[model samples]
Target: MNINIKKYLIITLLIFLIVNCTGNDSTYSVEVTNPLDSERIDEFVIINFDQLKITQAQQVNNLTVKNGETFIPSQLTDTDNDGTIDGVAVVLNFKPSESILLEINLNSPEKSKDDFIKRTYAEIAIKKSAEFKDGKYIGGNYENINNVKVPYNHIDHDNLFKYEGPGWESDKVGYRFYLDWRNAVDIFGKKTTDMVLQNVGVQALDQISEASYHSMSDWGADILKVGNSLGIGSVGMLDKGKVIMVSKTDSITCTVAENGIIKSDIRTRYYGWEVGNKKYNIQTDFSITAGSRLTFTEIQIDNEADNILTGIVKHENANLIKQESSIENDWSYLATFGEQTLFNDNLGMVIFYKNSELLEITEDEYSYIIVLKARNQKASYYFGAAWEKEKNGITGEKDFVSYLNETIQKLNNPIKLSYK
Candidate 1:
């Protein structure tokens, strides 16, 4: 074979081998169907690729349901599998509907108890100090420590001393008297007595007398009360607006309104005022079952007052004729009335119309009457009037008189006329 022809033949053979290997490594498809309805089989079902050891799988091209319709995968398959293709599920159950709330049982753990005691002691100590000072220790000035306003007196000094010791001591003291002079003999007493005195001097000294301390043991009960107020280690059911801490477990059911306001059976305890609106009724050993039901009420307006005419102005025939000619000449007429009318939070309803076609009005005359009737009897004290003009400057005195009478009559009792 020629050299060039041999090279071409070798390249063709390599291409053929590559194509054959690629075909052999191609992926295959597996049809998946819901057992409940084999006819409604889906093309793709998700599976962990790593766990299933599937490097590749045939792409899902279409999905179909028997007697239903065959749809393109992009067209028919709900992306989220929620009934709607827009990812909104209209009828599919996809996630859990209920939720669980976990509450910590503070009394069950020993560590919680110890933490509670420590927290309680610290809190009470601070509170006691506050109560001791009232409003005197609010600022940096300590002159009002005991409300005496002494200069340079420290407010926290008493508290510090309570923990430490008193500052000064009394100088008064008494000594024991010896009765027998021979027994009380000094330096010449005995060598044994001297040894006893030396031994006593070496013993531990009584430091209690040296320290001027005040014992808090007398206020132990008060301190404990303060601790209990802090809700240290107690466990209780949150009921109503309070926390109910009980000794035994009891089943309690409460209904919560839709407004999220709780009206439970628990009562307020000590320090309730300090807790403010965040108070929880601690019920001990009690479990709540059901909450309160929410109720909503809507209000509707029933009867409304109707507008009554306080006064009216009638146009004379001569004046009507003059006004008609003036209106035709591009002039307008005005009506005036003055009276104080009570509106009382009501909207004013007004309607204007004319008897002649030459007289133009902006709104539908019948609709305005209907609105005025709906007003019931709400009176408007303000004065109002209607304007009239011809389409082409045609002055008709008779027509003008008729229009004026009609408009005035309409103003007096526009609401009485019914459109329906």
Candidate 2:
């Protein structure tokens, strides 16, 4: 009886060992490759023993591509040959709410064009609504960002010219129709500026965002208002007139017609400069000469601060005194054209412009007198009278000046052109 029992026990022990070895010998292999890398396939390989089963019932939290490395199921294996588990192989079994097949056509004649189109399409798909909600992809402001609908405001008109002669005459004229700030901020949020700055850098970002956010519909309404006032696009006699559309950036210029035709929109200047800060004092000898039929349609002032002068003073010409006065004081002259002011409380002229026809001259002789100035002010202060007090920094006068210059420049340039 004892021998028979030992034999049976030995057989059972052998069978258990065999089963354990078989289970340990089970192997699974997975190939890892970089989707972004165009050169090579099968970038790496990983193998797993003992065929670990992943819980398909659970949902995935998030997935992301990090640092040119990708994670695969087989890669999640114990490197140290110990009985303890080191990593896990995840198999997500939950049915996707929706599956989208992103088909890309790269049949472009040019390789560069084909690659660009393919990459852009891939980016759009990765950010698509379905993939975002499923948690298959991560990063980007997906949840917070959406197609927002808000009132649109665009550039009514932007006119720029090098003034010359005694009166204002056009040496060169450039205009831009752009999106308004209030409307743009309403639709795209204030972060739109940061978004654009990321793409185009600090210089062109604001202009591009302001221009692109506003559509042609906004442009049409604004143009109609201006045209109706001038009786150009009305139903009567002036319907068939020509409409001229123009836009000018610091570096380039563009123009188009009302019939969706592109006209003389070319890059005249290769380089451009932008105002750096709010308050500045730039002395440039610039001038504008206008003809007798010149009419000032609009005048926009960017800086509403009490003391800041945005005007023109000819070299050695002192008659133009664009002064500011305060109602609080005894009507004291706050700032003079050629002089500077210490604080923003002193009243000053911010901006001034008038629309006038060009004066016909024997020769194309003109000059411009440019003057830019700003004031320094206490932005914030504590009311306590004792020595121990608190103070905070406010928007600098130079910073205000910079914003004003940028805004005024946009107003002077329109993005679209039309024919009456």
Best by TM-score: 1
After superposing candidate 1, which stretches have Cα over 4 Å from the reference?
A: 37-44, 56-420
For residues 16-128, what per-residue lDDT tens digits would candidate 1 score against the true structure? Answer: 99867644433222222222211211112222222223232423222221111321111121222112222100011111221111111111221221221110000001112
Q: How accurate locally, in lDDT, is each candidate?
A: 0.19, 0.19
TM-score of predicted structure 1: 0.15
Candidate 2 matches the true fold with a TM-score of 0.14
**Residues 190-299, candidate 2, lDDT per residue (tens digit)?**
11101111121111221243433233221110111111111110000011122111112233211110000111111111112122222211111111111000111111
Tell me the TM-score of each prediction against the true structure.
0.15, 0.14
